[model samples]
Target chain A: MTVIKPKIAVYKFTSCDGCQLAFLNLGNDLLKLTDAVDIIHFAELGMVNPNAKVDIAFIEGSIATPHDLERIKNIRAKAKFLITIGACATAGGIQALRNFADTAEWVAAIYPKPETISYLATSTPISTHVTVDLELWGCPVNGEQILTAIKTLLLKVKPAIKRDSVCLECKRSGNVCVMVTKNIPCMGPVTQTGCGALCPSVGRDCYGCYGPSENPNTDSLSKQFQQQGCSRETIQRRFLFINNQAPAFLKAGMKK
Target chain B: MSMKMEFNNQEYYFLPHVKINALLDYLHHQGFSCIGPQIKQDAIVYEELHDSEQLPWGLRDYQMPGQYRLEENNVKRAFSWANGPQAIKPQLFKPKESLWRVARDSHGKLTFKNVTHEMKPIALFGVRSCDVAGMLIQDKAFLTEPFVDKHYQARRENVFVIAVNCGYSSNNCFCVSTNTGPQVKAGYDIALTEIDDGFVVTVGSAAGEALINKISLKHATDEMQQAMQREINNAATMQSKAMPFDNTRVVRDLLMNNLDHPQWDDVAARCLSCGNCTSVCPTCFCSSETETPALDRIESEHSREWDSCFTEGHSYIHGKVIRDDTKSRYKQWLTHKLATWWDQFDTSGCVGCGRCVTWCPVGIDITAEVAAIAKPAVDDSASE
Candidate 1:
């Protein structure tokens, strides 16, 4: 009798590569994970099998270059279930700050030869280019969440990831509301909860490492920051940081 | 021990503020976890109290829309303010609980086993009238005839409530309008009204009478009861906010009829669709279940977690999200909270504790939204 294993692939584009590292960082689970699924393509793991058909594909990063646009389409077409991991793939990561700026002018200023650099105008999410079956949010996607996503996918069930804001986790963990108590400008209310509410627990404000939480009220949070005496630059930078390209945060940051 | 104590005639009792620890001790002796309001995380939240010293004695909360702060004052009363962000919902309906488990037996056959918890009787101290009302609403939800949640029933069965009648209203509180608070008429073991020196305690249930007998409570005079009533009446009448219009029909009718109203869009523009309002709402019982399968696929566990309607996926069916836009989702939430809930539950879901108003990052007041919908009549009649 022949045994068949589900093929898995991990791909990256224009991200910091932190999200891909999370899978390897699974440590003891890495061996068990490899046993569970055939990792056909994982560049970070030194296995590079591109253009090969896979059962599941974990896509990291956003579409920043013209090549990325084409590559992502190929990935989407080949993979049965294309799961987007990390804020870059889900909502366009930090480099998405360039979405607000002129890419041509940016290239002109940064490069010695102006016309040599080739890139898209806006750093857009993977979903902007192709259908994403599941999205694991966070600057570096949570390892547990990634595992849950995989397990759910194996069962042909929709992943049970919380779309609630960081405030829920913060409250559950009994962390004081930094924005409320200290009058600090925290994005916990608008930001997603996948990061385990790291920032606010340690006495700092959430910088929205995960993209917008479900129904993110960016306007209200922005107004709160303003009331907390945050400068226009501060408010702008707060929304435009990790997940700037997120539609909700982008509008709030750009509002005034 | 099984005999139900009879003391319905002795309704009012007194507990000197200093000796309130006796009540906590008595509950502890009965193998009950005493849950009460304590100052933590910048605001007062219900926490397990091993001793009465853990209570937020001298603290008071300054609550407003989008704002909450715990300030230390000279007020010697233990339970001064109405209530905090958390209600009895988390207690009865756990935020996250393992319902059951599934595993493969030695014969390689899948076996399902229900998760059973040895739940201790929980004595909730300092619960407000509005929250008790919220619990009653939840009781209708989890304990209803069609499908009763066994998990909720098991936990709720042994719970005891020590309610606190509001001596002063919080800035956003309007339990007066809802007719659920300021003075608790039902749904408590013992209702305490804080006065000059101590609390005027009133028994509600048989368990309350038994507990009263256990603690050395003094006989309450008619004068003391009158004073407590005056204090409660003052708190009710002095409430700064209430429903701008009657919640019975007009507000519900307006919201239901004005599904396409411009006010929804206006509110949606400001609304982040953040599920904070629903999460903090005591009566919002929306939940989602998930299955966690093991690596071997032989074992799996099912769990239920709190879910909110604000999420696009909450309305997702097949391959499409029903309420795609924020405006429609917000309208759906508002309509359900005020109107549709009445039709479904045979009562209004809101208890008017003002947690939604205070906790909303944007401060989207439900009352204000209703007022905007029921504009002309509300404006004319609203005297507060």
Candidate 2:
């Protein structure tokens, strides 16, 4: 009798590669994880199979380049279950800040040769181009969430991930509301709760690392930010940070 | 000199405002960690206090919807404010705790170890009446069940409550409507009422009597007792803050009848679904359990952490989420808290400390929400 392990793959496109590092950051769990699933392809682990037919494929990063556009479609075709990890693939990442500005102007300002770049004007999420089975949200996805997602995937069950705003977890951890108590312009009320409220616990405001929580009340929080004396630009900039292209934040940033 | 003293089945004494440290010292002498509100990060948080200096004496908090500010009060009353950010919830029902440990030995047999603690006496100082009521509500939750939370039981057993009858109320207080506040009626060892020059302390339990008898306390004069009662009455009247609805019955009935009310959507548009209300709520007792397996995959520990209904994962069952929309989730939270809690616990869940209103980022007021629903529909055709 043979026990068959699920074939797993990790791929990256145009991200900072921080999301894939999350898989490696599972230091102790990484060893035990190998016993549970077969890692057929992982560039971070030095195994590079770009077209492996995998039982589970964890895709990180956004579709930035024209070539990336075609490549993600191919990966989607081969993966039985495609899971988007981090803000890059779920919502357009920090680089999606370009979406708010002119791409040609940004390129002209940053690059020496404008004609050399072959990137898309808007750095769009993978789900924008290809269908996604699930999304694990974060700036750099939480390592524990990745392990939990993988284990749950192998067991053919959905991992328990909270879609509530960070304010919930922040309060549960007994952190005084920074926006209320300290009068800081925190995005915790609108941001998803995967990071276990790491920033707010330390007396810092959250910048929506996990993208918009379920039906985030961006309108009301924006009004609160204004009442707290946050200038229009400051309120706009708050929404344009990590998960820039998330619909809720994008709308807030664009609003008057 | 231990004079035979009796007042309402226990001893009654007047503790001078300057020697309030004596009470702290007395509790400390009895092998208990004195826990009280101290200013931390601009908010009053419950922390271990070694002396009266740690208490928020001479400091008063101004709390409104979406705002909290601490200011100097020259009056120098120790228990000036009604309550703080943290309640008795964290002291008894912990935010996060390990329930038990499961380990697979060399023989491949799993061994279970219960996460237990030796009961230690905790002297909870300056606890408000609403919180004492909240603790009793939680006692019904954790103590009496087909399953009991032993960890909570252990902490609860050795608690020495030193409840503070409110000298004043904050802008957000509405405990009068909840019938849980403005005075410490029961569920305390000792109750303190702060007046102009001193504190009128009344013992509520045997332990409280023994501790008060140990200290050199002047007998509370009839005038002093009347003055204390006068202060308590003033404090109760000063709570002009009342729920917009008539009573808990009206609020509960409105929620029960108006399941599809557009008011939910109106509130949900402002509601962050952040669970801040539930987390800060003294009576919201939903929790979720998780297993933490060691790197070896053999040793594992099971733990339960505070969970809120506002979270999408909280309603997830059979591979699908029930409350997918923010409106629905908010509806479930408010309905459960105001209405169904009565069905489950024979009492309303809200104690009306108004932490939910003050702590909410958008400052969505529960009282207002309840009132909005309870209003007679002017236009029946209106839709969410």
Candidate 3:
């Protein structure tokens, strides 16, 4: 009997390529993943097929350009399962800060010839352009999470991604609250728990790198930050940073 | 002379501040790991203690709503701080633990194996009265008839508690209102009240008496006893926060009657629903289970982790969430913790350690919330 491996592809759009590094960081586990699936296209790893029909497609980055808008739809059409990896593809990432700003003004300020730049007015998540089967949220999606998602998908099971706040993970790991102890303006209470409570564990405030958690009460957190002596601009900037385009964060960040 | 004297639970002795090392050393010699409070990550937390030197000596903690700061007072007293984020709950009811594993053989026979952890007997030193109360409440939940948690039982059975009477109380503390703290009442093998020079130790169990017999302790003089009582009384007076009503029945009735009270909406608006309150709550005992299947799909490990009502997953029923909004989730948590817990376990879930108030990032005080809801109704009725 012959066994046919699942064809897999990792695609990039407008990203920092940090999410792609998560796969490489898998190290020896990457070899195990390769044995389980056929890597038809992963341009960063030197396999260069832009258009390939695959069982699973891992998308990194956002749909920033007119070309990205069309490419995502094409990728969606080809992929049996479309999984958005990292903050960029899932929630429009740090680049989505452009969504809140004047794109024309910034382009004109940066470029000598502004008309040469061909980009959309707003940077949007992959889900904005195409139907996303699953979303793995993080600044750079955790390698273990990506591996687990793949393994579960291979077994025809849905991946169980936790949608709890970073505070939960922080508590479980026995880490003291940076916000409570040091009066630091941390986003752990409202941010998702994918980074294993990384920032707060290291005595730094979480900057919401994993996006807004389930039912994130950003208004309450913002009020808390304000009470902790954070300025209006600082509070806005905290919410509007990495996952600025996320609906809950966008609404909160835009608040006066 | 150090001799095995017939000591009862009521007997009090003085163990000098310098002789605390002897107590820790004795526990270690008895094949028990001594766990005590220490300064970790800017907060006082319970960690493994090898000697009395590991204790948070002279470190006074200032705890307010949404704030906790530790400062050196240059004193020599251990267990001077009120409490930390956790009690002894995590020691038995772990944050995350594997329950069991299942494997399938080549012949398709599935074998199930229980995943039992090898835990050493723990001597929990420097525990607080509220924490002791919290443990008893947890005992009612986990160790009661017909529904005994075997995992919790395994760890709890081999445990020894060395509780401490709170010499000082933080700003958020209201154990006096809850009638649970400032003085060690019960549920301890040995209870210690820290005086300026030494601890007025009261043995509460045979094991505690046996341990005390091994150490040379001076008979607690009336002066030392008076000093211990004075410190405990001072701790009670230090607390500004208090429950609106001391009666749990009245509090429970007020909450149950006012399920749709506007205060719920007001609190929900301010509450992040981050589960921080529940996480810091020593008596909150909700856990969720997950099945992790191997890549081969032949084996799986079942695990349970601490969960909170704040999450959408907690109220998840068939195909939909019961508590879909923050209002409903917050209502569920507060109601269950303060009101309905009595129905389930014949006691209030809160031990009034004020951990929830101090640890909440947004500083949502449970006592204040209860007061907000209850005080209005009482005022209106009184006016009538």
Candidate 4:
């Protein structure tokens, strides 16, 4: 007979909520996944806060508000294996753009009463506040990868995905490149490999929606972009867009 | 030697139509998963072939600056993959969609399962010389990375590569400059140089040599080898550099300084964060993951799929998008791949495949951009 299933929790902070939707996108795999674990808490599905102790926890989004700062620490303390999913949870997400600007001035311009709201000046990942066993990347985490990480969690093994650029996936799909024929700027050569060369297939450039890979060569690729007639602003804007919080993109984005 | 075989010097291996059909039967019986070119949705695509009829023989394809059209020609028994828009890495490396999840069910049971890698021996027929270089470059990303990808390693092992030397070069083909083309180098199990009447096939591996023996072919004379060399040399002579951007150091130094170069604002004006450039690049590999649920909702499954860098939500910090300005984000992508990647991986990330040139809507060519920045002195150097 199966013993008590391991308890699992899904948490979110600041994001487009696309990462949480990634869980809902599990489709047929959702039932199969549930058969393997116990879903103790998932606020998006109305699982509520103050979740119970469990074997694993999947946290989405980044820590932006003061309330999130305390909440992240508590979640880390309760879970035995904590994994961060999506760009927001792993690299601080697009919200990290705030790091390069005058936060007070931007806040004053937007909010009616800037003093009334209390939040962290910098939006950061769970690892920034505590420890993270695994990092599942992407702007909105891919559902299939999330499942792969969960299995690794139960088996007590390391993750299988590594730091390779999107170019690898582009080659694997046998799709003709959009950049070469169209003279377009594609991030496929430099961005990490998780998105299967999707944009190029449909005639679009990579905005770096996924974050950085391990040992990424941002400087070298940027040099190549310059060779392609890309202006300095064009190159910098690409980095500052989707994954400005990722150290690789952040360093380039905040270059000013 | 334990074995020796002889063949007639006068006879050629260009078998009759009937024998050619029979040869297909023999290859199929041996469990060869043949891959060749086929038209897909109007454009030609390379995929698996179930039989001999599926092979695009006697087909010469014409490519313009931004177009491709296939025409039947007698002199077309070579790898027409000759500077096509696509590169062949993902077939031997990464995939688009994958399942990786750990979650809990309403029944209070913990569950976790990942999609298992598959075993499929593939025969990459009619591969161009530059594609072999593309595969070698992929090794740097998937195999050489800190955590080796067992999936890629396994898939690569099952792949039997049959590379063909290109007879002609395209205007956009830059493999010669990249040291990746015209003739197949080491990575292949077999290499073929197409000549009149039949192909001059050379076996690079023992497996290829055994296949050569099986084909009942003759010993190639010294003249035949010279002709093969001549074919490759001709291809190289036809290719010339489109851009002369040799100074990579200046480009790297400029990016490293973080001096807020004014050139970036000009770039941003025409920039579209759609991600066409990165997707078609031979080396870019950034990605993101996500999860989708089952329709029943009894249990939710997690999946780690592909993501891109160009998306606004990608750089969210807590709840904020980090890259408010698109200009900086674009800069990070190009610099990392061309400049910093050398430091991280000990080699230039790009193989100069030239896919980024045609696939881009705005036609952003990396090689051209480097030449402009590497011009020695920046016009706005005094502003700093």
**Candidate 1 vs candidate 3, DockQ winner:** 3
> A1-256, model 3: which lDDT tens digit per residue?
8789999999999999999999999998898778788999999999989888999999999999998998888889999999999999999889888886899999999999999999999999998888899999998899989988988888798888889999999998899999988888999988988788888788899999999898899988999889899999999999898999899998998999
Q: What does candidate 4's lDDT look like per residue over B178-244, in tens digits? A: 6677787667766677665456676666566656556666666667777767878887787754433
Sorting all predicted structures by lDDT, with the top scorer first, yields 3, 2, 1, 4
Interface RMS deviation of candidate 4: 9.8
Ranking by DockQ: 3, 2, 1, 4
True contacts kept of each: 0.50, 0.68, 0.76, 0.10
Q: Decide which is better by lDDT, 2 or 3.
A: 3
TM-score of model 2 relative to the true fold? Answer: 0.90
Question: Lowest-lDDT window of 10 residues in candidate 4 chain B?
Answer: B1-10
Off by over 4 Å in 3: A112-116, B1-8, B377-384
Model 2 lDDT per residue over B1-384, tens place: 001133365446898877778888988888898888888888889989887778887888888887888888877777887677887899888888888998888998989998886655788988999999899888888888777777877778888888888878888988887888788878888888888777888888777778777887878888888888887787778776677563466677778899977787788788777788888999988988887655445677888888888877788899798988788889998888888888888888888898989988888888888878877656767977
Chain B, candidate 2: TM-score = 0.94
Better structure of 3 and 4 per lDDT: 3
**Top of the candidates by TM-score:** 3
Instruction: Locate the minimum summed-lDDT window of 10 residues in model 3 chain B.
Output: B1-10
Per-candidate local distance difference test? 0.82, 0.84, 0.89, 0.65
Output the better candidate (1/2) by DockQ. 2
lDDT of 2 by residue, A1-256 (tens): 9988888999988899999888888887898898888899898899888987999999889998999899999999999999999998988788998887899999999999989999998999998998899999998999999887776666466666767778768767888888888889899888888898999889999988999988587888888889989999999999988888888888888898
TM-score list, all predictions: 0.88, 0.90, 0.95, 0.57
Tens-place lDDT per residue, model 1, B1-384, is: 101233355467888878788888888889999888887767788888877778888888887777888787788878776667786888988877788889987898988999897778788988888888888888888988879999988767788888888888888899888878888767777889988778898887778878889887888788889989988988888788887554575667878787766787788888767677888888988887778887766789898877778776689899888997788888888888888888888878888888888877767888888888776433445687
> Chain B TM-score for each model?
0.93, 0.94, 0.95, 0.80
